[model samples]
Target: MTYISRAAKILSSRVSADVVILGPTVIGEGTIVEPMVVIGHPVRAKLMKALGSDLGIDEYMDSISSGSQIGSNCIIRSGTVIYEDVVLGDNVETGHNVLIREGTRIGSGTRVGSGVIIDGETIIGSNVSIQSMVYIPRGTVIEDGVFLGPNVVITNDKYPPSRRLDGVRIRRGAVIGANSTLIAGIEIGENAVVAAGSVVTKDVPPNKVVMGVPARPVYDVDVFIRKRAEYEGSKAP
Candidate 1:
């Protein structure tokens, strides 16, 4: 049998309570602060400490790393490490132990899954669904409504042993499967679907589906659009 830990239970004890001290911290009022979680933000933490006697903030830097920006109405589940200069929009939800690096702009309603590593200077659009353990390298721009499967690796260097080149751009609504690796400088078109474990090395056309290593077309529109339309019409209400 597994035992679950409650956040409220840890904060109840004076000796057991782990205090955090920060500058410019701006957490919302009536927010539940769990025990043993150290957060740093100088001015805001000091302001909140003066107001509430229930608050205890004196060891933030000793426990958690600094310079992370957490927005309002966000649910950062336990064990998450948000890196510096990462701008998370409102209503973003992150699972445990997620890593969002510096200069990353994740749009509103984006759900960064557990254990995912989003590298620096990347732009993730609104409503994007990234699964666990995905590695989005530097300078990649993932457009809105994209679905990334678990363990997908998006590389930025077209040439191996590269000298800090820019990353690839995945257009809107593209679905990349688990364990897939996308090569740099290629533009994946909108609404395209790449199958699991594929290696992307070229440009993918819009509204198409590809599979296998070096990802070739398997489900082009010419092969199934007419049949699909007939099926849709037959089932119309």
Candidate 2:
């Protein structure tokens, strides 16, 4: 059954009846919320569950949820769970079964593909394209026009289960290839390209192309662009 909190401000006309909107969530105009999408789910719900609180779902959410904001003209696909305190800018789109945790902010025109998991407190800039099955941990920052290919993994903890957390920063117009694993605390410079299946451990300088296990610099972005143009020219019909 779908549940909408009395405090929610729903301005959209395309919300499905099976969607759950809790707390004081705001659904903007022209947005399409697919079936089984849960918005404004409280982050403290887990704590309450752990503590075995007897409070009902509505009562608990009302007490602890700060709510979330879904901007105008957005598309939130099915089975997506957006935690409280998350903000999505206008024209953002998410694929099916995406999980966005609390305190996350996504800018306008960003596309998060299916099965993507974005942990809390991350900032994603405008027009970023994240392909399918990407895992973005907490504290990550993706600048505008960045392209992350399928199955890209971004880590925040240097050591597993450690207290210290450092995010990977992808500068504007960078392209991270498919199946790449970006380690913690690395900065991918603007317009840089990471070749497919690379395990990036260090910061990549601006406009360079890197490949291999440790992801060494292979060439500059100018060379990569020229090669790309040549390849495209060959493929022209």
lDDT (CA) for every model shown? Answer: 0.67, 0.94
For residue 46, give model 1's deviation from the true position in Å. 24
Candidate 1: misplaced stretches above 4 Å? Answer: 1-66, 221-237
User: What lDDT tens digits, residue by residue, belong to model 2 across residues 1-237?
Assistant: 588888999999999999888888999999999999999888754555635667876666655677899999999999999999999999999999999999999999999999999998999999999999999999999999999999999999889899999999999999999999999999999999999999999999999999999999999999999999999889567
Cα lDDT of model 1 by residue, 117-194, tens digit: 876779999899999999998889999999899999998887778686758888998888899999988888898888
What shift in Å separates residue 35 of candidate 2 from its native position after superposition? 0.3
- Tell how far residue 158 is off in model 1, in angstroms: 2.2
Angstrom error at residue 166, model 1:
2.7
Worst 10 residues of 2 by lDDT: 44-53
Measured with C-alpha atoms, the lDDT of residue 122 in candidate 2 is 96
Off by over 4 Å in 2: 49-54
Give per-model TM-scores.
0.70, 0.95
